[model samples]
Target: MSVAVYIAVMAGVTYLIRVIPFAMVRKKIKSEFIKSLLYYMPYAILSAMTFPAIFYSTGNTVTAGVGTVTAIVLAYFDLPLIAVAISAAAAAFGVGFLV
Candidate 1:
């Protein structure tokens, strides 16, 4: 198939996926449970997509785990994002050097 055809198919699928939800739901959602699920869905999806990559990013699970732990601990203490990131990276790099 040509690239244009592939692009068109992808665009159509994306459009349909976005449109179907609106077309099916004509009124405001009222269920508290469903509302809570929807509210947290994006964070859940992002974590699902991102969390596993953390484990494999350093090419060594031990370093990756140490980095993840460092990041989590720093985040728990409300450290700045830059501090958390740098500390995690340093922790990973230091572990990678040692192992």
Candidate 2:
């Protein structure tokens, strides 16, 4: 198949996946539980998508991985987030030199 056709088909499928859910849900009664579920769904999805980057590594591509972990730990203890992130990134780069 041509590249244009492939792109078009993928785009159509993507649109349908997003549109069908709203169309169906709009026709039905949404409970408070369902409303809350929908409200927090994007954050859940984003976290799910970002979760793995906190650990896995192929080589020394370490900053995004360990940096995220460090940021989370420090933030949990009420540390300044920007400082934690900077420290994590520098630590990762420094660790890469040792490894």
Candidate 3:
């Protein structure tokens, strides 16, 4: 019920999440399937966390969608990160004014 209790519970859960893996896997992993799963897990988790937030970030789905599309297009073209970010923000800002 208290904040300290919540924080302590969270800390215990986080510690277990990190420790359980190390405790379970002591030898080099030989399975390609498992290896690939581990390799892609971070990206999958990051996308899962990030994708939904993108649509709600600007408080307007239209502007957020425009910005997301702009970012995706620029990233696909392998544009510089700075250019992609600024262009996305500008696109979102301009769309915000219109919509």
* Candidate 2 lDDT by residue in tens digits, 42-77: 999978886675565324556556666677788788
- Per residue, candidate 1 scores C-alpha lDDT tens digits across 1-99 of 799999999999999989988788688888999999989999999799868999998889999999999999999999999999999999999998888
Of candidate 3, the 10-residue stretch with the lowest lDDT total is 20-29
- lDDT scores in order: 0.94, 0.74, 0.94
Task: Return the lDDT, model 2, position 91.
Answer: 68
User: Candidate order by TM-score, highest to lowest?
Assistant: 3, 1, 2
In candidate 2, residue 8 scores what lDDT? 98
The better candidate by lDDT, 1 or 2, is 1
RMSD vs true structure, all candidates: 4.1, 4.9, 3.1
Candidate 2 TM-score to native? 0.50
Error of 1 at 42 (Å): 2.4
Q: List the residue pairs that clash in candidate 3.
A: none
The residue-by-residue lDDT of candidate 3 on 1-99, one tens digit each, is 899999999999999999987888678889999999999999999899879999998899999999999999999999999999999989999999897
> Which prediction has the highest TM-score against the true structure?
3
